[model samples]
Target chain A: MLSMQKVSFRYGKNTDYVLSGVDADFVPGKFYTVFGPSGSGKTTCLSLLGGLDTPTAGEVLLDGISLRQIGGEELRRKHVSYIFQNYMLFPYMSAVQNVVTAIEISGKGGREAKQEAEKVLLSLGIEEKDMYRKVRKLSGGQQQRVAIARSVATGSRYILADEPTGNLDKKNAQMIIDIFLRLVREQEKCLVVVTHSQQVRDASDIRYELTDGQLSLWGEAAEYAEF
Target chain B: MRNFSTIAKRAFRTISGKWKGYALLLLVVAAITLTLYIFFFWLDASARLATQARTSTEACILLQSNDRQQIGSLPQAMREHPAVKGSDTTTLLTASPVNFVNAVSRQDSPFDLPGESDQVLVSAHTDIAMSDAFRTGNASLVEGAFPTGSDPQVVIEDVLAKRNGLQIGDSISMSLSLPGYTEPHQLNLRVCGIYHLQQPIEATYYTSDGTPVYGASPYSSVFVPFDTLAVRFPDALSQDSVCFYLTDFTAISSVLEQFRQLNPDPARYTLSDFTDYRYEQLLQASQAVGRLILAAVWIFIGMELLILFFAILSILRSYYKDAGILIALGERRRCVAAQFLFQILVVGVVAVSVTLVGAFLLTPLLATLASGQIVHTAAETLPGNAVEIGAIENMARLLEEHGGNFAMLYASIAVLSVLVLLGLSSFFLFSHTPTRRLFDKE
Candidate 1:
């Protein structure tokens, strides 16, 4: 389980807090989504969960150990994976290479890594020919699939995505949502996705809304909630 | 846990993906390398030539005296002086032209002429072979040998021998007026050798009456064994100059002081100043130019390194997104930096290789150009006969032998500069910029 305990964040010393005393728990075999308007710190919440950024206050723990004690790099490399909203695939690498690199960075490489990358990319509906082309040459939906494939190929326990389908069309977004559901059900992985899309929020098993520097369950009072 | 091969493979991909930028960098680095190598070559060749010129040119001190005993004993004294390691002394004497047989004029006469209208003026020396012309290869034996033994053997100039129809076995007769003799002394000398003068040198001598004779051409002179001449005419006036072959020409003042100590009395002996000051000055000027070239090389390297630093910084900035992606994917920061380092190293190796090959191909041409410049400078600054083409050739040969080493040294420096600057720039870019900021568009 990856959990954020009383987390608070501010950009700098004099800035107002973006997240104040917020708490959340992400467990395996569950699909969760955090939805909010602009400036609600939804991406900041996901970044903290994935060890991409350290919380200014409070602790992020993986399986009851503090993220700091586990070391951010080691936690990210061994237990967590991320899918950025912009689909930050290495621009110079092909789709398959991007997936393969993530797997290699996760400490599984060689011929098996290449085979696994191609399998994951193909399962995401990316064609064999497009997998070898640079990601910049791929379409928006294809790039998102490649990004998802990169996260899934690492086989980490926690998959933290910031707007996984923000740029995708309806059909691609639904496919991505279905992939997330299957990852949670069949693979028993923890999926925490931050998005503004109602479709993503409705499809998830658990949902929360971030507003005014507080996190609350959907349809609940606008106050920080501990879960 | 990333291995070197994995990092290297990723680095190779990055390099090949952005080959255009790396290609431009290679070209810039190669141009800088070539320029630096040329400056180094110039400095090395100039220094070597200056040293050759300093060591090869003869530095001498002329010694003159009216006392025969003092002047005659001076050679033995100078030979024993610790300062004169390779020194040689030659006593200059002039033969009277009265009743001197003209070998060239005798060719037209069937009978012997006792008093020929054309007289052969002769200058005798203790060691005629030690003159500058002979030492510097300006004069060579044409048919006969130098007079070495204590015989009345004479070596005449080729021009005189040819004009007089003389051969090696022929004899020449001269009449000398000695101080102790009441009548003129007649002597017959065998023509044992003949020498050709490639360049005529003006010689000065003192007559038996101590009269200074200037503008005497070697073409009209003959070489007789000094012991034979001195023993035959003990009162013969001679002009003697001691040539000191110093181990270090720069310490000439100390050697001159030693020479002065040996012959202190100004009334009996006088020493001429060392005559090769211009050559020494030229060497010093060459050394100054060498130093200037070295300074210029350092400044050029500094400018090139600055350009390289900025270029690397720009590359890292452009690749910020890639770095963010790699870091997000769990690649260590040092591993990412190593990727970029390997990228720059690929280009550095290529540039260094190209520079080595270019330096090899251009060495002869550059050496020739350098030699021509040195020779031209030497000709302008030195006396006409003092400029040695052999010294210039030696400089070129030395440049060839050591030019490759110089190029290798500079190539190493170029590669090392790229590595050091890349490491610093990587640290600056990676250590200061947060991973989140790397994803920012700016």
Candidate 2:
């Protein structure tokens, strides 16, 4: 389990807090989403969860141990993986190579790593032919699938995604949500997604809303009521 | 946790994918290398020439003594001097009778033949074959060999041999007039060798009617073994001169002072300073030029390194997005830095290899070009001496020896420059910036 305890964050000393007193719990075998307005710190919350940034005032812990004690790099490498909105695959590498690179970075490398990467990509609906093409040459849907496959191939327990289906079409977005549901139901992996899509929120098991540096359960929030 | 081969493969891929940028860097590094190599070659050649010109026999001093005992002892004394590298002694023989049988005669002959017949009068004002004149390249042996040891042998001039149809192993008779002897001592000597003067001596003789007749043909006297001459004419009047080669030309004044301490009387022991001031000035000028070239090479290296730093910085900056992606994929920051460093090193090694091969292939041509320029300048400004020209000719060999050292130096500097650039860029780009900010599209 990964949880945030009264976490607060600001860009710098002079800047106002982007996330204040934020609290959340993520467990395996569940898919969750955080929705908010443009400046509601949804991405900042995901960054903290993924160990990309440190909390200002509180603790982000994995299995009751503080992230600082676990070390950010080790936590990210062994416990969590992130998927960005832009499908931030290495532009020069093919889809399979990107997943293999992620696997290599996670310290699970060898000739077997390539077979594992191909298996993961094929399971994610990427064809064998498209897997060898440079990511830039792949479609938006295919590139997002490659990014998700990279997260899955690393075998991290928690997959933190920021707007995973933001650039895909409606049909492609639905397909990605289905893939996330299958990952949670079949692989028993935790999925924490920061998104504003109604399709993603409907597919998730639980939802949270971030507003004015605060996070609250979706149905109980005043913003959700207004929406 | 990436291994070296994995990181190197990624670096190689990145370099090949972005070859245009790396190619530009390679060209810049190659240009700097070529410029630096040319300057190094010039400095090396100039320094060697300067040293050669400085220590040559042109910087020697001559010590002449008319005192018979002092003349005999001054050579051994000068040879034992600490400052002297070597010494050569010459004894000028005068009015020795030389008779040639059945010789050819010309109208402009300086020698008065008997009754205009084929008998030639040869006045052998000879010196030793190993005298200062021959040692200094004033004359060279054309046929046979120099008289070695005391063999009662002589090497006549080429013109004298040609005029008299003389061949080697022919007998020549000379009489030395010893002091307090009514009769001259006759000695029969064999012609063992012949030599030609580098610069022929002009002859002016008076006819019987007091008209001066100039000879169109050049003439020079004979050479004999000094030991034989000294043994045969023990009491003959001889002017003795000693040439002293100093170990250090800069200490010529001190060496001259040492010589004066040995022979204090100026009238009996006259010192002729034959040190070539022009050659010394040229040496100084060459040294100054060498220093200037070295300075320019260093400045060029400094400026090129600055350019390299910025070039690598720009390259790293362009790769910031890729680095962020790698880091976000859980790659260690140090691994990313190593990958980038490997990329730069790959390009650097290729550039250095290309430059070295190019330089190796072109060294002989460059050396020839440099030698030609130095030889032309030396011939114009310096005397036509064999030692100076030989030194100029040695530039090719020196360049070959120094070229290897220069290549090694260039390789070291190039690799060090690349490493420094990588270090500075990594510090600026990776150490100070956050990974999120690096890949942040906005």
Candidate 3:
């Protein structure tokens, strides 16, 4: 479980707040979608959940323990994995090699890591022939599948994806959403995905919206009330 | 091991994929290493040559007699001194044959002897300054070779030979005259060689009345083997002081000081250590040249390092994204640095190895460059007003004998410089910027 308590954040001293008095809870085996318009603090909340940045005030907790106490880099390595919207794959490496690198980084080693990478890519609907191609040569849908494969290959408890389907077409975006749902429903991985797509928001187990640096539920008049 | 291989493989792939940038780096490293090796080798060679020249050669100490009377117990006293007894000393009977050998002065002779009563001087071969002059081309045998052993042979001066019409194999008669003897002893010696002198000779002996009478040197003198003189005219010879030949020239000053304490009378005799003084001057000059070479080498090294530092900074700036990706993948900062260092070391080793081979092939050219300066320094220390090429050749030969010292020094310096440049350049780059910021750049 990942939880935030009265977290506040600003980029620098004297800059306007990107997030203030924000509180939320995330549990395993559920898919949560965070939706907001441009500059609405949605990505800021996702960055915090991924352990990429720390809140200026309050605490972010993981499994009832503070993420800061666990060390941000160690937290990302052991418990959280981040997938960027544009599929940040090493351009020079093939799909399998990219997945293998991620597995090795997560402390896995040897021929077993390579085999596991191959298995993960194959399960994500990447053909054996396409799996050996460089990520740059892959189609947009295939590239998204490889990125999804890389995040899941780590087997971390929580996956924080920032606009994972923002650069994809409707069909490729739906395929990525299917992968996220399968991870939560079958693999019992807690996932927090930030996006502006209504289809993605409706498909998630729960929905939250951000406005004026504050977080609220998608529906109900009291949801947008100040804390 | 697995983790390290992973990073190393990544670095290798990255370097190989973009070989152009790495090729430029390799070229710079090679140029630096080659120039440094040449300078370091020359410095080592010059220093070793200087030291060998300073200490190994023989130094001669000539002792001139104070009076015409027979040498007393002073010769024995000098032999007992620690400095004299510790060295190889050969005492010779040096005298003027003026009273015995009658000759007329030649028109072109430099000496101004009285008319109609001119005489020649004779000395037994002592194997000190005479041999040095012959070896350095200060005097050359114009006819036959130098007389050796106890042969009743003589080497006449060229001017006297020409004036007297004397030729090789001609017997010259000399009547030895002495005090209180009504009969004069006569001896005949065959002329073996005639020599020409290149420098003005300052005659050391005087006439019967204390007036200094200069001789015509090689032009109006005769030289025979010391053993022949001692055997044929034992009563005519005087052995006052001996010439002490020291094996190590650098010890001459100390030995001279020690000898003075033993003798206590500087005016009673004259000591000449010109050979030792000459070597000392040469040693000092060569050392100065060595210092200059080292200074030049270090300045080039500093310039090369600065170029390498900035070049590496620019390359690392390009590598920021790669470094950031590694950091984001949970690699430790040291691991990322190690990966970069491994890449640099690969290039360094290649450059150094190439330089080593290149230096080997260029040894002759490098030796010539080093020898030219060394020869100039060595020649300046010679007795002549100008540096002689013969002396330079002799110095070059000495340097060649000790060439291995230069190679060892060059190897050590090359390895040290490569390691230092790689370590410092990488460490400085990593310490200045945060890896996290690199990862977030689009």
Best-performing candidate as measured by DockQ? 2
Least well predicted 10-residue stretch by lDDT in candidate 1 chain B: B93-102
- Report the lDDT of model 2 for residue A138: 91
Cand. 3 Cα-lDDT = 0.68
- Which lDDT value does model 1 have at A171? 91
All candidates' TM-scores? 0.75, 0.78, 0.66
Number of the candidate with higher TM-score, 1 or 3:
1
Each candidate: what lDDT?
Answer: 0.72, 0.71, 0.68
Which digits, one per residue and each the tens of the lDDT, describe model 1 over residues A9-107? Answer: 987999999999998888999888888888788878877876778899999999999988887678778888888778988777899888988888888
- In model 2, what is the error at residue A50, expressed in angstroms? 2.5
Tell me the spans in candidate 2 whose CA falls farther than 4 Å from its real position. Answer: A220-227, B68-83, B86-225, B247-254, B275-310, B375-391, B400-408, B411-415, B418-421, B424-429, B438-442
Model 3 docking category: incorrect
DockQ of 3: 0.17
Alpha-carbon runs more than 4 Å astray in model 1: A220-227, B65-240, B246-262, B274-310, B374-388, B438-442
**Stronger candidate by TM-score (1 vs 2):** 2
